[model samples]
Target: MAWPNPFRRRTAKTVSHYGYTFEWTDEHLSEEDAHKLRFTYDELADRVLARLDAISPPQKQPPSATATSTTEKASSVESEQSKPASRDLYALLRDNKDSDPVLRELWDQVTTVPEWVDWPQIGRGQDVFYRYGGPNLTGLAYQALLGGMGGARVVETLARTGGFSIKVARRRLFETTQHVLQVTRSLDALEPGKGEGFESTVRVRLLHAAVRKRILGLAQARPSYYSVAEHGVPINDLDSAATIATFSSTLIWLSLPRQGIFMRSAEAADYIAMWRYVAYLIGAPTDFFSTPSRAKAFMQSVFLYEIRPTQTSVLLANNIITALHHQPPGYASAEFLSASARWLNGPQLSDALQLPRVSLYYSLLMLGQCAFFAFVSYTYRAVDAWDRKKIEVLRKVFWQVVVESRYGLEGKTTDFDFNGPGLILWGLFQHVVRPQLHWSEISRCRSCFKLLPARESTRMYGVHALII
Candidate 1:
């Protein structure tokens, strides 16, 4: 007994560590507890079995087969994501075979416009007054009357009326109607129908018919598809005909300077309509104030008045207040505003010298870089104190310029602000706030820096970089 220690004895009564020893007892686990224990045992056993299996053997498989499977899955995902969400004309036609002939005719009439018509060749740029001059005056005047009753009304109306849902429709109607009036005024402008004379050609007739039908269809679809505010108030609740008429008149007035090239009133109107329609479809504003210059001003104001100057401006204001019992150091709101104002209004020698049209685009690119820097500086200061969502919204508005500048629809060279907005947007992207999310394609295009020959790259880089 003294020779053998009980702890070290190898005997049948000694329990083996690796093996289970079952003993019957009166105590019993509840169903849940028993199930949990069983599950734990199963998991442990499965892990053990897996380890044993991994060390036990290796399965032979074809590398090509595995690669093909992975490739197929990736291809499937890419295809699904790449497909456009909207229905095409042909598909819509095929789907609506059983509909009324009138509706079908309307659809056919609208779809007749070629998807890729050479808009410039069709005299798309005829209305110089409505396109540029009128808007410029209005925008300049509007900007001057800062924080007035008129300004308040304008802001309120715009805020209430313009939203994601009805924006496209409103834009379409505004653009098309304006162009129609412009072309109507310029009798010598190109006609969509057959060639040149008073007699309507098939192309012109077809185009006109298509435009009319599309307009009608848009009108009909408005009630159903249009977005309403929380109070069920439609964005375009204002008198449609009056609003559109005024808008059209304003556009025609702006494009008056280009009247000579349009030659005919009809051509000018058509061209203006097409141009505005295209702009609207691409999520652009119809007026100059909505342009980058104005947008920048608005953003600056928001940052100064609503964001930095207020107690609620910073991300960590509340946190700081709570931690320090409301006796935390006060941020210099005025200093921040002054700094931002200086950045915005700062004189740059480059802007004074007018470069060639192509060179001008590059200048915009530089401005965009400046904007990006401003955004980074501002955001960095507030990041610790602001709500993530609020920060993101501000960032998005700023970055929109960058994205729009790069991917926006093409516009004419004479439309400086239209194209320049993209440059301003680049500035906004760079300065206002950094976007929390980014598209690689957009980023790549924005990142592209080169001053190519004006003639060669104007359309290429200009089209790709700034809004046309």
Candidate 2:
């Protein structure tokens, strides 16, 4: 009689991804993708179950084979495992990134830079980033995570490091804010070389290089679950493309009108183009999202094929909401964060993530915030000089409130490094050096709980200030 292994879990049915039916072959597959192609879903299930059975307690041999078992264990040790042939992993990763046919095919089909897309016009687009569309950056970050963490590999990796935990909120928000500022500054740079430098900073490049190295190493180390040979990169070119599209097209462009904020077509195009350029600098594939329309289409395709409702997504979203619940100035309540997420990603995604339903009053409050912004958006474009000036004052007040909400008026920060493996290391460090701060006891912002701050006395806009 055999004892059944509980670990030998089987999925109810094989779910096909949206783009899986495309006539791609083994030659076009990554080692990870190709490894999967070697077996049908049923065969793979059978193989997994068989492996589980072999390792099951019932299958253990008697003590007579102890010597053989010891010898096998010695060989199976991590230090004794046979090393692969000497080759550059970085070179291999670059080759994979460049040679991926699926990504190349998608790029060719989707990318279309318009003839009138003036590269210079992107400079003017920075005004919009810090002005009308600033508050929605948080929503965009949530959207990116919602999409990126859909993959089991990414979510599991993030989960193990405890990065998605509540204690890491300040660090995460700061890093995200840095990235946002970098993109905005890069677009507004006067010198081509200076602009390139901002995009390709040593810290930024090192951070990207470190991340790529870690991801590939993770794939190599965890072959059965995560394989570069099987899946390629965890955050592959397509994922990066989707991320760029989500930020530039989906969150920025789509959210504006839905939130009742308005922008002229030309202004929107400039904004998209600016982000398209940022996408290139971030090592996302060139020309894949050259136009706003292409970005939208790419986002749709990615959401269908790559993004899905998974336990992993829910776990990450839980972490984000918990973390935001702890962070400074405290206007962004857990309820507001949940509601904003629902507003941005829709009810299906919100429910999939197991977020609590926001109350009707909060929903109306969210709409009111949007309406106020929509008024600001329109008033900024008024022909009269004084009308526009008053709007600018309002925009300044909003910006001050946002900054204070995240980092406070003095912007006090912990001495942790903001570059290299800082975030990665910090998240891991929290498990040991855990600071048990009582989040709810922290003081709430007077502005958010009370009336809006006076526009005349708002702080000067120095942090990532717009050239306009």
Candidate 3:
């Protein structure tokens, strides 16, 4: 027989078997042998622990008094340097430039002189043009809107363009080169005669990185609502983030020594003009008026007693003839005539053309125009009788005009611009003026009275004259 296969197993059935029986080859290991090859949990745990114990512990260090003292001294030096320098606005302006001989001489005298920082707060009206006065073109534009020229499109356009220009200047110019110079100057000043080193350079780089990151964060949060075409080339995709970053960086550059000395001076002049324009729009405080209060009061008396009476007669004559066609039958004609006469004779009308009251008058003019439009629609049953589609479109335009008008009314003139006025005027022309002048080409003309010459005002006014 061939040699038996040692790994082979044999199985058999027996008549008197006590249990199922099986046979293994001699080459196969027994159960006890298999168990001997394996390690128990206890043995594995011991082996791992023994290996870990073989590694050595790190050595400890003792405290050093000299090193501690050095650290304390370094911290004290840092604290001294951290204190901000006392800034003199005038001196700050002078130290930056020696190129202008006139300014250089002026700067020399300014250093020895004392000046008011907050001139407006100190009751010095002439000093309001100074940088510290807090009123500028931006503030003036805001005030003008509050006075009633709430032209949303125009304000918004101006704000967007102006903001973008400022943004571009700050990002491409101030933040990059000028900011670096400022940082270097600050570092040099802090070190006395010592030059800036690698450490300061690294710190400046880190600060720039942080500022850029903040700027990026703002840009990502408030993406531009307007198109690149709207802002122009420099600030094509400028968004709120870019705007905030630019503003912050510009403010920083302006505050730096020497960099913004001349720029700030020029800006001060612009600020005054802006403030005056704004003051004109909103009716300035009584104290700001050139004439005395008594003089203004006397003028009011003259206007009410003399000038107004003549105007009233003219208005009465016009209303009497116009009322027959426009007014409903019965007491309507009489009531409108009486109201017209009363309004012409009213103290409010006299005050309307005066300082302070001009704002009120403008407001009333706008309101009356709106009310007259509404009255015409009601009288002709035009709005209520319109098709659903026309009504919906009109409704949308109405709300848009109203909301933008109100925004313009609020002191948010910077929020809109000329475009806003155009849009409102367009809406009014489409909804109100269009219906009344459907037969005339003049009525349909979008730019009818916008820039018409003074001579054409009467002719154009007649062309769009309301039946009401």
Q: Among these predicted structures, which one has the highest lDDT?
A: 2
Tens digit of lDDT per residue, candidate 2, span 1-468? Answer: 011235554454322242111122222324353233222221221232233223331222223333557667776575544743322222222234245543233223223333544667766565556455434453454455543456544455455334565565445545445455444543444233334223232223224334444445556677664555444454445545555665566655545655666567776677777766655544455364666555555555555455555786687777777776635543356776666556655565567678779898767665655555566556556645744454355344443443334443234322222222233211100110011212222223444222333344332121112211
Instruction: Rate residue 403 of model 3 by lDDT.
Output: 26
Q: Lowest summed lDDT over 10 consecutive residues: which window, candidate 1?
A: 419-428
On TM-score, who's better, 1 or 2? Answer: 2
TM-score of model number 1: 0.25
Per-residue lDDT of candidate 3, residues 1-468 (tens digit): 011235555555211111112232333334353223221112221222223223221122223323557777788688966754422222222343264444344334322212322223221222222221111111111111111112212223323322113222112211122222221222232221122222222222222222223233334566573322222222111111122211122122221111112223333333333222212211121112222222222222212222222332333223222332232111222223223222222233223222122244443432353344334333333334432333333333322322223211111111111110111100001112221222233323323223222332233223222221
Provide backbone clash counts, one per model. Answer: 55, 6, 16
Q: After aligning candidate 1 to the native by TM-score, how far in Å is the CA of 64 from where it should be?
A: 45
Query: Which one wins on TM-score?
Result: 2
Provide the global lDDT of candidate 3 against the true structure: 0.25
Better of 1 and 3 by lDDT: 1
Ranking by lDDT: 2, 1, 3
lDDT of 1 by residue, 340-449 (tens): 22222122211111111224433344345334433433343345443233333332322233222232211211111111001100000111111111233233444232
Task: State in Å the error of residue 356, model 1.
Answer: 33
Total backbone clashes of candidate 2, pairs 3 or more residues apart or in separate chains: 6
